[model samples]
Target: AKDNRIRFYTIGLGANQMQVDSILGPITVNAPDDLDEKILEKLANESGGMFFRAKSAKDLTRVYEKINQLEPVKIDQTYLQPKTPLYPWLLAAAFVLLLIIRVIQWR
Candidate 1:
């Protein structure tokens, strides 16, 4: 994920520090063990991000909130679609012209 301008907030489920370290960026490892301190200390040092160990549901919620805070999404623009039915009007006009033509032919 390079040169894409999109930052990643990876949540590694059941991954060890040795495995998470091999990856780049802010990665939260939700593993069985808490995680090695040496790895956690150096996690932000190299990638300029934080490493969180999600042990429970609350931890996972906090991690998601942190990620949202880091990368806040904003809508750039809004598009509106006009709601109009023109086909019925066109059909009505055609029927009126046909009726006029029939009256002229009868006269």
Candidate 2:
């Protein structure tokens, strides 16, 4: 990624343990411990990015918002111009055509 100038933002979600409900009752089991946060953090650091830990949906939303704010997209305004409205002109043309048709029919 460094050679290509690409950055990585890593996110780790959930806690060490999670609760699940079964026929027996509510049970607490170990969460997925296979997620190596150290590697995620290292990748973020090496790629000049950030590592975020989100325990809930709200935390994940906040992390996404933070990343969006950090890397904002720039738009070129020079190519933008005000829209030219042609509706009124088209309406007038239609009115004139209707009048001409009405006069021809009357005659």
Candidate 3:
């Protein structure tokens, strides 16, 4: 938590900044009551990240969206995706299998 190399994002559900400050400092185990702003702010501050607060469900979603906007994951779709058309081959195989089953049943 004290390391600065890693980045941490914290979301406080109901606790305000002041309340968060009071609860966080240096603790081995955090109680459930202080699990809100205190823990999140501490982790974020120590790791050079941000601490966001959300009081309600809507606010929570908004905070999460903001986090995503801030730090977006990069996906390399060009090389990671297959170039061949697999669906047509799969459909043709399935049709052939079904035709074979039908032929066997007729015999």
Candidate 4:
């Protein structure tokens, strides 16, 4: 990614263990045990990016906002020219020319 100038922003969510109420009773299970935070951190570090942990929706929103602030999109404003309607002027000119032609024909 360094050669291609690509960045990676990694995010890990939820906890490793979760509890659920079952008919038998309360059971403890693995929630995001498959998610390896160390791999994510290594990837972010290698790609020159950031690693974020979001436990809830609010934290995810904040992480997104921080990423936006860190790397804001750049738009080219050089080609922003205001558009002027030429059809209106062309229609007026055509009407004036038609009126003049009719006046000459009548005379």
Ranking by TM-score: 2, 4, 1, 3
Tens digit of per-residue lDDT, candidate 1, span 1-107: 23444444445333343234544766555546654655664644455555665745677888899988987889869889899999999999999999999999999
TM-score, candidate number 3: 0.48
Model 2's alpha-carbon lDDT is 0.91
lDDT of 4 by residue, 1-107 (tens): 96797889999998566678999999998885678999999999999999999877898999999999988999877876799999999999999999999999999
TM-score list, all predictions: 0.49, 0.62, 0.48, 0.58
* lDDT score, candidate 3, position 66: 90
- For model 3, the stretches where C-alpha displacement exceeds 4 angstroms are 1-4, 14-32, 79-107
Q: List lDDT for all candidates, in order.
A: 0.65, 0.91, 0.76, 0.90
Name the lDDT value of residue 29 in candidate 4.
81
> Per-residue lDDT of 1-107 in model 2, one digit per residue for the tens?
96787889999999777788999999998887788899999999999899999977899999999999988878777876789999999999999999999999999
Identify the candidate with maximal lDDT.
Answer: 2
Q: Can you list the residue pairs that collide in candidate 3?
A: none
| Cα lDDT over the full model 4 | 0.90
* RMSD (Å) of each candidate, 1 decimal: 10.6, 5.4, 11.9, 4.1
